[model samples]
Target: MIKECCNKIDNNKVLLSMAIKKKRYEALVQVYHSELYRFAYWLCHDPTIAEDLVQETFLRAWRSLESLQDDKAAKPWLLTILRRENARRFERKQFDYADVENNTLEDNKSVTLDDEMEQTVIHRQINKLSPEYREPLLLQVVMGCSGEEIADILELNKNTVMTRLYRARNQLKEALTDNHEPIKGALN
Candidate 1:
């Protein structure tokens, strides 16, 4: 009778453990999936690949869920998983070089906002920035991560993250000003 009782208790403990894991995984999906997907998109510049990358990241996260000790560390943990997944894509295979001129993705269309065209210009300039500057900027601006979080995600020091962010904003400001100067000169 005591053995049966112990078995029941063990089964109950297993069930409870599974329930807690499910709850945590569900919460993670709800909170970080979109943000992770956006970061993946920015990294790869392909919507389909970005979706796949997020799926793989979450899959790996689930497999290693026990390694995650703190709730606060989840964001950086997930982002690190995602960055690794993106890097692995390059390691897997080498694709033939495609002609850049014929690529449809190169086509940029201008969208006017109150005759300003500011949004389109900014989007283009952001895309123009080097990946070193753009990645930190996107993580902070889009994901709303702190410098420490960004540093953890990017595997850099906190000071490096801050410095990159400052440089990114200054570069954007200068590039935008330079772009508009020609129009201002034409107007004059």
Candidate 2:
């Protein structure tokens, strides 16, 4: 009888724990959805890709939610998930060299915005850079991650992250300062 009673108590505790986990997941989805969406949007310029990235991020986060301890670190944790999702997406999709080269050669005026033309201009220029340069910039600018955090997300050494970020900024500055007339040999 005692053994049976202990088993019943254990089952009840498991059920209660499950209920709490569900509630926390729901609350997390509510609070971080927008931030995740925005981060994904900047990662991929397309809204559809952003939605997919955020969805994947949340799905992974849900699976690993038990490992997460600090609620305050949720934002960075979510960002890390999104970045990994983005990388996995590229790996699974399997881009051809021709396709990648062709894409890099394309013009990127699509990054335009109404209110902040100059900033938009700079953004488009940044967008034009190869992903090696673009990823770190977005992590820093859009996601507000520190250098070490960016390094971890991008899976690079801290020095490498710093170098790429420096190069990205310098390239953007040059693009912005270049003559108003488009460069003669812009890829696209």
Candidate 3:
């Protein structure tokens, strides 16, 4: 009888632990899902692929949640996971190429046609930047990561991250100027 009662207590403990873990995981998903999806979409330029990447990233995060020590580190942690998931896509299979022009732009806000055109131009310019420059800029601008967080996610020193960001801004400014699409205070 004592053995059976001890077994029941142990089972209850296990259940309680699982319930806590599930709650934590759900909270994380709610907080970070949209940011992760935006970052993924910019990285791949494909909505479908971005959605898949976010799903895969969250799946991996769920599997390895116990390894994450700090809750404050969650954004950078999730970003790193997402970057790896994006990399894995190349290893798994070659994806069919899609024309960037053909992909539909999804905008929730009401903006004028001129504003939309300007945004398209800016996006194209951003996409033209090399990955080394582009990735840092995206992390900073899109993901809203700080210099330290960007460095941590990219596995680079903070100085290196800042330098890349500087160069990226310069390059983007020059591209916009060359294209005659002067977006005032765009980089600021």
Candidate 4:
């Protein structure tokens, strides 16, 4: 009877460990996978590569899951992994830049020509922003990360992240205003 009890306890311990691992992985994927993918996509500007980077990031995270000591650190940890994965891509190979004609930026299906033109202009202006300014803004707007989270992810101070966000907004406003003034003048 004692032998059977010992076997049961051992089985229960094994099951509990497996369950913990499963929950951690599932929770990580459920919470951060999309955000990580978006961050990766903005970094590389390639959907396929972004998907691969997120996959690799999560794989690394799963391997080191126990090292994550704080719940709040998960997002930044995942983002750091993703950023490293992106950097490693450059180390592995020197990729040729894609030709502009081959780039397939999405076109919003709008019935009005003005709406389509407006979206195109906005997208172009965003693409024009330097990486320093662009990345923080992407983390805020796309991933919905707070300034502190962005700072942690980007390894910048919170003030720096705020400054980048400010500059990014100002640059976009100026670009749009400059573009629209000519159109308004023509109408008048």
lDDT of each: 0.81, 0.76, 0.91, 0.80
What's the lDDT for residue 61 in model 4? 92
Q: Find the candidate with the highest TM-score and give its number.
A: 3
Over 4 Å off, model 2: 69-72, 92-116, 179-188
Which pairs clash in the backbone of model 4?
A: none
Query: Residue pairs in steric clash, candidate 1?
Result: none
Q: Please report the TM-score between candidate 4 and the true structure.
A: 0.77
Cα RMSD for candidates in order: 5.2, 6.4, 1.7, 4.5
Tens digit of per-residue lDDT, candidate 4, span 1-188: 99999999999999999899889889999998877877787677678888999999999998999899997899888988888888899999878766422222353454466655665566567778998987788778777889999999899999989999999988878877876743331212
lDDT of 3 at 145: 100
Ten contiguous residues minimizing lDDT sum, candidate 4 = 179-188
**Most accurate candidate by lDDT:** 3
List where candidate 3 sits over 4 angstroms from the true fold: 96-98, 102-105
Candidate 3 clashes: the total is: 0
Compared with the true structure, model 1 gives a TM-score of 0.79
Ranked by lDDT, the better of candidates 2 and 3 is 3
Tens-place lDDT per residue, model 1, 1-188, is 99999999999999999999999999999999989987887677677888999999999999999899999899999999998998899899654435222111222565345334454466567778998998899888778999999998899999999999999988888887877743322212
